[model samples]
Target: MSDENKSKTFLGFDFSTQRLKAVVIDENYEVCHEADVEFDVDLPEFRTSGGVVRGEKGEVTAPTLLWVKALDMVMDRLIVAGVDFSTIEALSGAAQQHGSVWWAKGSKERLKNLSSEDFLHTQLASTFMADSPVWMDSSTSADCRAIEEAVGGPEELAKVTGSRAYERFTGAQIRKMHRTRPRSYSATERISLVSSFACSLFLGEYAPIDLADGSGMNLLDIHSMQWCEEALKACGDEKLSKKLGVPVPSATVVGNISSYFVKRYGFKPDCKVVAFTGDNCSALAGLRLRSGWVGLSLGTSDTLLLGLQEARAPPAGHILVGPTSEAPYMALLCFANGSLTRQSHRDRLVGASWEAFNELLQATVRGNMGYMGIYYDTAEIVPRAVSGRWLYDASGRALDKCAPQFEARALLEGQAIARRVHAEDMGFKLDSSSRVIATGGASVNKELLQIFADVFHTPVYVQDKHANAALLGAAIRAAEVWSVHTNTKLTGSEPSISPVATPYPDSEAIYTPMLERYRQYVDTIPKLQ
Candidate 1:
């Protein structure tokens, strides 16, 4: 690569639940600069707890202008960090999936005529119709049921929209808005997912939702990669389709940076804005996962991601169009009880020391000597269960308690097994050739990763930089879109990954029966309920 090519940087932004993060990468994918703005800390006037406001009955939201302020703050921080915005050739971003932003009437005109003299929040203070109902919100059960009823049932809804009517999904959220807040719905001019809303801020107009992110809404037809007419009517009226602009391919260059950004932030007038996508899809691109490979992100909430040659709308989990045009489809399975559950158990049973926790885990034998457990510090998504812990002895008799070491091992093994079972149920196959790429906070725990390897009967690998996968993915998308648009070939080695753990020789034999037993427990729980 020439010096000029090396100097050209691509920027990726992540509008996550808690913060707005940005990463800049050179042509070779080396991270050059990074910055973030935490909504609660940096913009405390909004009085958000964990970046959202909670209300009665599982209502969670963030003020729409909070994000606008975050954008301004993050941009200023990037400049203060000595980042040259003009050198950035292109940019792309990802946001928390399923959060919807309603643009009030005439907001597009407001976006187009933004003044460089003022901060974005001040200029667009009244642009939004209401606080955004985020992915964490669970106040839409009635809306979900209505939507499911409108389109047959849950199975048929999944067949058409790549997901059942999830309460947090955009379709259900939109229905809630239309039915409960009819005036806001009537005054709404456009509906943008968190991803496209971020893109619109850059493009100076409403940006189309990308196919990959659009799939999360329970509104897009996964097979055709377009909005489903039936699903649209289920969400709102005839104008609902227009509120959501045409969905575009994830890598499509939506437009150039808005003049406000060009003037205020020194961004080049020609800097391309690639279509933004959901954070999960961005991580898939960032990890460079191939077919048959699974990406496990072990953060506050664990997520399992894999690529699919053909789309399958499973009875659970979700299916999204792949971030890049080359890949066909992708699956995302979220487990709500992840690191927090692990931390709680470790604190209670092992004195809050990870080293002690690891020692206990390593000392205990696999399958906990026929003991099995399922722990849910909070509600679980994969199984859709309530909070509690269930433990059983080898003979399938309920156990009131067990040894601390057995408890630790059971916790790790159970989480791993649950991931594999749910993933396979989604049609993800496993074999000698299959690989599991682990990322996020827990991936650093070699002992935990070994449990993952052993339970899945596959090798587990970790990248040099796993924490920034989503931000890196956005940067990668920017570079890819730029390469195609300018007809330039990128010359660089792919990001490197190193194997962390390989399956034990007897892993399949040990876990196969355990998997069946685990399924039996899961199947019995609903009956007990």
Candidate 2:
């Protein structure tokens, strides 16, 4: 590893809610290039009428052509940004989880439309049925419950998937189609996450779902790395389950550089297209966490991530399914409301940027909110649901009725409490022997960092450099390939360390006693209820 020997580059993109972000990095994780794409509703939007019908507030797909256009517009932005697009060797992606992009097999040339809008109109959507049920659409709980009941309830499913079934999961979405939109389910030929869809587009063939993204679906057998027959039978139409594309190892190589590439970015026809993974796994890879290290993803949803030496089943409402372990083994604790609650609600009241939102949180005095004995469990997606329980005696009761800010603080602390409880449930012992890296929207907040420090009681480090570290991590893998494909023999691998993170001592001051009360509430509130 000579300072003179600069490594080659790989490109990484995280296809997140309505956006695709691409980052290019050399072997040492240095940024060489970057770009992005955003999505508008290409599907016929549906609104929920209080669960009256199967309409269930889920928007069907937009014409495939429209999405392809959106993708190209994004690609154009990159070319303008000065990306070499050609010298890049491989294309790997991290996409939003639980999306289903349907493609029918074509002749030797496989004729299809880009999910772009230019080619298809709304009328065409009805014919091709191209929209994917994204993770944000939480309209399938009834279907989730049914699957749970058929499979023997939440605990049983958790034993296999490391997660409790959720409506946005592939299992529920597929089940919904089977029961209500039977025709569509029957007509469906293949389904893959948006990440794999990205890979498939470049492969000039069907792309397999990576283990990291597959576990989100409740259909993948977390342990065996195969689809569970019994789980499929429970959902409906076991035959349709077979159509659920092959389960590929997260690191496996898919065919490289398809016509889509030659047509879109003009990268080399011989470039490799490796397996694409989910955003969470890519984020973990971005940070380059180690065996005992933990990475917290504070996105629309919050996921507590830790790498595993091998795969393990989640006890309940928890999941361990990804190529990050044993080729892609990583466990996750996904809370429905993470930074999203703030993204949705922060504007109306605070009128602050998310960064500024943390600024205000930083201003609050710890334990000084004077609100005692009250924990507002506003969105209790994980841990125990407290329903905004009140805790305290006479003096503390005053602290119970928090202003909007207090409620805001509660949202932050409540999630931390959930993380603590989940970690305990995960059953690992952490000391100085462990390393914790905090990355994501929420982690950037100094106030939240202080609160986290108080809660975790250890120094919290922030990856303050890039907005796309996860994408850069994928690019790092590409650098690995370049080293293998062109340069020398395998060599010593070293750890990737972010700058010694600015300490969250200010957050430490804010969380002091408020954290204690929050913990007390966690223990007594559930029992009291």
Candidate 3:
């Protein structure tokens, strides 16, 4: 290989819930190297578990500077791992959705002049409001209600913004901050979603929020792909639109890597920076999901995503502007208690071993004698179900509890059913060729994969890398945007990694009857007040 050809690489970052991770990929889309900085374990001074501070009334936050510190630590770790920064031709990233970062006045000036000698957090202390409400936060019910009413209720709001008012969304979070902390709101110079915030760190200026992630904010008019004036007014920010800056396409080349990176890490002076996007949208780009396939992510929160040729405002779930420019769209449904809920059941009933949990799940018969369950250790995003686990008999009668064997099967079945039903509501169709491509920490479990296959009556597939797809997608996007920026040969648009999953013959027969019962079960559960 020629030196010039081999010298080029791309960098992708996923500023996920608990960690900030960097992945370096070669021209061929192979993951060449990876490194991560864990928030709680590595930066204990922030005192966060899973990268969030929990408090009364369902308040959830993370120190804004903690993210900055993670960026520094992750980069230093990458340099220590012997990554050649000079080879990185371009970079992009993904962030956990809906978390907002408030920049103090003159923070951009501070960013533009970062010195190699000083740490990022050291120079940028007090640059943010510090609370930065995240996706797990549910303290914005009042804001949500007000926004819904302002926009003519939930359905109308959904039609306008692609979602009803969501507590974790940026619109509600911004309204809460604006109302409760007028001083901070007034002092804030600009607002960036976590994705744009990370991008700004690299651009040395505030990056505009990408449409893919901005759609989650409940502030964008999904149809027009512009910020909604009424939605801004509804959020109590008449001047908020200016604070938000203009939205940009997800794959747009934002700018060159900031001089800070060049001076600090010996990066190319002209290394390009692509716009960052929300994690889910990045995963969609990473998976290269076309029609007839749906991606199921089983992480801290379970999310089901499908690519859409056209946009629709479902009363439930979300429709993000697709990662690509043009007319593509994405449909998403999120469940708050994903792996954690399953892990809790595993710990309580199966000794906290995934193998043991699978054993019990395998031992139990299909449908667990007609028992169905909804497990929400915390509040759920879809259906907005009440907190606590709800179990039901075959006939849809509520039960106080079920046996351990039943519990294991029920949890898996309930989650799978929810994904299937919700995806259908969003206009996803299943066929002989349709596949459920599973990814996340839990996707590796054979037993769980089998349940996904059986419940959806579709084959379930997992990637060989088993790495974070969102991060990988960022790397892919960086490559795409780099070609445009450099005016070089364009890379292929499809995802390099393909998933492989098998289907059992009896899956359809096993799950078909249970599907009907699930509909009844959901209706019977009382809504949390």
Q: Model 1, 147-200: lDDT tens per residue? A: 888889999999888888887899999989988899999999999999999999
Return the lDDT, model 1, position 335. 83
Candidate 1 vs 3: which has more lDDT: 1
After superposition, the stretches of candidate 1 with alpha carbons farther than 4 Å from their true spots are: 1-6, 40-49, 343-363, 399-405, 526-529
Q: Quote the lDDT for 156 in model 3.
A: 90
Q: What does candidate 3's lDDT look like per residue over 341-450, in tens digits?
A: 88888999978588888888888986678888888888878878667778888887888988889988999988888878777777778998888878777777778787
- Which pairs clash in model 1? none
Runs in model 3 with CA error above 4 Å?
Answer: 1-6, 325-327, 490-493, 496-501
Return the candidate ranking by TM-score, descending: 3, 1, 2
Residue-wise C-alpha lDDT for candidate 2, range 336-436, written one tens digit per residue: 56664555446744775776566556665554354443333232445534345453432545243455555556556666756766675776545665656
* TM-score of each model, in listed order: 0.92, 0.81, 0.95
Taken over the whole model, the C-alpha lDDT of each candidate is 0.87, 0.61, 0.86
